[model samples]
Target: MNKHFYQKCIASALALIMFFSLFAGANPAKAEAALNINADGAILVDGETGKVLYEKNADSVLGIASMTKMMTEYILLDAVKKGKVKWDQEYTPSDLVYKISQNRDLSNVPLRADGKYNVRELYDAMAIYSANAATIAIAEIIGGSETNFVKMMNEKAGKLGLKDFKFVNSSGLNNRDYKGEQPQGTGAEDENVMSARAVAKLAFHLINDFPDVLKTASTPKKTFREGTEDRIEMINWNWMLPELDYGYQGMDGLKTGTTDFAGYCFTGTAGRDGKRFITVVQNAKDSSGKGGYKARFDETRKMMDYAFSNYSKEKIVPKHYQVKGQKTIPVIKGKENEVKIYTKSAINMIVHNGDEKNYQPVLVLDKKKINKDGKLTAPIKKGEKVGYVTVKPKNGEKVSFLTGEDQIQVDVIAAQDVEKANWFVLMMRGVGNFFGDVWHGIASTVKGWFK
Candidate 1:
């Protein structure tokens, strides 16, 4: 294949691999399979539980188009959460904002350079319409300047544990100098990219950390009729909504993005029977780029359906649980004779019912472990981490890492250092100690009563 063909082929192949890895899970025969896609990277995870249900190159960093808007939402909502801004706060657009909003990379908010909008309208334009101008307006309102706001965005991402992505601009529009010299969102400075997993994670924070934002994002089929400039047509780019697909009625608001470097991308959420899930699709094809959102909607539905149909978040093993280890070891002075280590996640693997028996929990003990056995000795302290019990769905499941328990400080010590004497000696000592103890006891009793 030519270099162009090679790149295209790799992109295609990577998309497929990531798609299967994400959605398919460990079981192949389970009928609850999701839709397939050509996105270079993808991931689907339970939003409420943080369980990764399906993931494509979910970890592979790729350009995410307007999905950057979600970060904008995060920053603004974070401000709202901290009382830095509010739903009704009004902000005026500066000339720099107006000048930048006019760029083709932005959605026309119809606001003049000096036009003022409340936080509500700015949020609406930005969330519902993915308005670039609205983003600048919101950024300025929150950060006192676009540069300052973008700085805050990067900081928040860091605090949230988003390592692969960064922001150099508020709108994520690639800035190019007069010579067209700077690359599009690919400059040495333009480092705004994220993996599907991280994007879904950020969405998790957005929906969970600030549900009000989701309330705004989920406004499917909003009618933008501002001052009647022909009520310029603006429809949600996400198809996984009631207005677009009845089956996807349970789906809620999220953000979408696309850039040639990142391809078509979306970070979305949906629910069914109280079980909600988040999804990320990167380099998912609009293949034609005419906005490949339809493919995203279709693929998202498949993954969500698969999750609800096959998995039910069952708690298989209750706590106070121990997955017997491969070997038991001695501790120095622990209250318990031996410590049991297990996996931290749970004995509950996302397995199909048919193969449930095939999986076995393993007692995984590490040779390096050496804690005093609780039964030996201690000023028993409760809740001190001892060791953990872990379970694996399959025996050879890479010997899933160990999980340890806090040393449950039992009240009694197993053995005291005081020694026991022979019968005769014990008798003599007992008689002597008895006489002394009795004399002392009587004396103490008399003294206490007198006092």
Candidate 2:
């Protein structure tokens, strides 16, 4: 029996290997973080459409650990955007930042006192190494104290329209007061947590808002000095940076973070053929001294592999192309008449081997099933919703995403369906209602009058 069990195990392993080898890129396995990645929240999206491809507990609120620095970089970049600071701007570690670094917090690039560091040096240090000191210096240099810097972080979060997120610290570290105790939910606290989806969205906005950061964050390794101080060499913490051929070398600039509470989190992007994909994974196990980090990297590679393998930007339907009949639908009691819908999302689909024109399509709408009459009942105004479609492949799950198909809402007031209210049509409806009302009214009136 033991021998048989061994044989089965060996056969299973072989089968798994063969499966991977055969179906390497067939369809992206619903992106579940692989073994060792016990992260509770995660998301994967196409960089082009910003459409989420897969998510698990994405909006779930959880501590983000040091991943908070991504926001720090964003705020600093905003300053640069406002011309408040130049790329070569000289920023010095303030007395406040120096003290924080002296405490030797979770992650810091210790800056020596009596020395000045440029913005570029600090940016690279924090970006490549997740240095605690580097982050504090940036906080102090940007906003006088990490406290003020943290407020700036919240402002940026607000600007990003982050609904499920709040900023308490410039770093992902837990908030601590002067006594080295955790602060309880007040004033730029470090207890800020966000869902995986929110973090991904934040990362996506950063990429869109500041594409330049990647040039440094994506570096495999770099060495730099601050004001002629000892040179610090730092390497990226994202393990995925080296494993995949296409995603690795071309990939640039992002943040990696980990803490006992937040596990490991990484947000990064890579481009091929001018098409880029931004990926966010949180709570990934990062036992660096152990072998857990590799699994996280492997999972990222798998997601990227699936995205590039299956999706390529293709225009499924041209703008203003009549899909069914009309452009808009009527929606009563809604903000607008008929809601106009169109797919601004470029259908990123992969087609091969004579399967070009064989794509079968179906549309679906946001409104619930309607049976008011055989068709949509009146009251739908211009810009009111109707339905959507499912664009199915010949062999697989239907593709329900199209630019104009899903948004085929009716333009209620675009033209009057009344069509001069044909006398015959009005008479039939009026007669049906009049007889029903006459009988009910007589019964009610007789009962009331008798009483």
Candidate 3:
């Protein structure tokens, strides 16, 4: 090869190497390490933002056990809010609920065959004690039948954007546990199932949309039918409550589940020092393969520890901040040739401590407002939303939100107005552009002839 050709080739190779190096810099120095959560599926997320901080087999479908009540709770709360039901409304036990309630082997706050219970009492039993019969009773009240309630559950799951879920019953029990009287639409052997991620999403919405649910969920114990002979002391199944033995500080208001098919599962939430986290551990087990109530809480504790110890709500992108290379965009036919742009609001999310430096802001402009040359034509208004800015890890590791929504972002807006140029100025510019194009065409032809 000639010397000039070899030089060009070396220069091209160097350019390619530099280009790859720039992208490679965005990758983390090491692969994302797992939390080693001992469960069939597990996930951890910031309670307020719903930003997923960690996950393990989080998308895998598995039995949810009594954690299924969270959905039932959600629906019932929605019904109450819409005035479709009232806390003082009375309920008469159905044949199925009576039979299930009498089964002392399962979780229950036994109901008298002829007893009349109100909505608030039934909800207390269902939420705190994981009472299967009470859950069914509430389901019946809202949907007119447990079968219809299951449909509502599935439909609501779809509306919530839940992925990997199936609701066969209001209570998270294997249908066979009901003998031949399972809810109308479900198979005899079917059980409620949800991915850890979906369960977290359910819990997220439950707490956010109906914050009052936490008031009852956090109750360590409550009396069902207090002052009546049928009254029962309903102890919460969630051992992590502040008044419980394994109680972690700031722990409160969540659900726990256990069944032969589902093993042990818990959807837990805790808040401390102005930060809150939601965690899900499904089918948790120990090294000996023994799964039980303690195992689920233990796994959840590990996740919470990881979250509280390592992650915190940090303002990764500040309001009015400008991206390094995208501080402004070109404008056409405007008094100003360019308009400055910045984030409309600050973006705060759960992030690992010391890892904030790895995130970089990326500007995404709205294509409808910009022309082919990537220039916006005036007149632009101040604070107009021109696009949005999202942040991503430099290491290319995927960061997901619990709701399966887009990553948290801030609006990218014009910082000031860019008025359209005067008519005379526009005409003058048009003439100048026409002459400039003609001169460029002539110059190109002459240059090609010389070549």
Leading candidate by lDDT: 3
Q: How do all models score by TM-score?
A: 0.66, 0.63, 0.86
lDDT of 2 at 152: 80
Residue 284, candidate 1: C-alpha displacement in angstroms: 1.4
Off by over 4 Å in 2: 1-38, 102-105, 176-190, 226-229, 243-249, 286-291, 319-451
Clashes of 2: 44
Give the per-residue lDDT of model 1 (tens digit) for 71-112: 889888878879989988877777666665566545555666
Model 3 residue runs over 4 Å out of place are 1-35, 439-451
- Candidate 1 RMSD to the real structure: 14.0
Model 2, span 368-407: residue lDDT tens? 5344532344444333435544355455633321122233
Report the lDDT tens digits of candidate 3 across residue range 130-165: 999999999999999999999999999999989999
Alpha carbon lDDT of residue 173, candidate 3?
86
Tell me the lDDT of model 2 at 350: 40
Measured on C-alpha atoms, candidate 2 has an lDDT of: 0.61
Candidate 3 has which clashing residue pairs, if any? 26-394, 27-395, 28-395
**Candidate 1 ranges beyond 4 A from true positions:** 1-36, 102-105, 176-191, 223-234, 245-247, 286-291, 319-371, 375-391, 396-451
In terms of TM-score, which candidate is strongest? Answer: 3
lDDT (C-alpha, whole model) for all candidates: 0.63, 0.61, 0.89
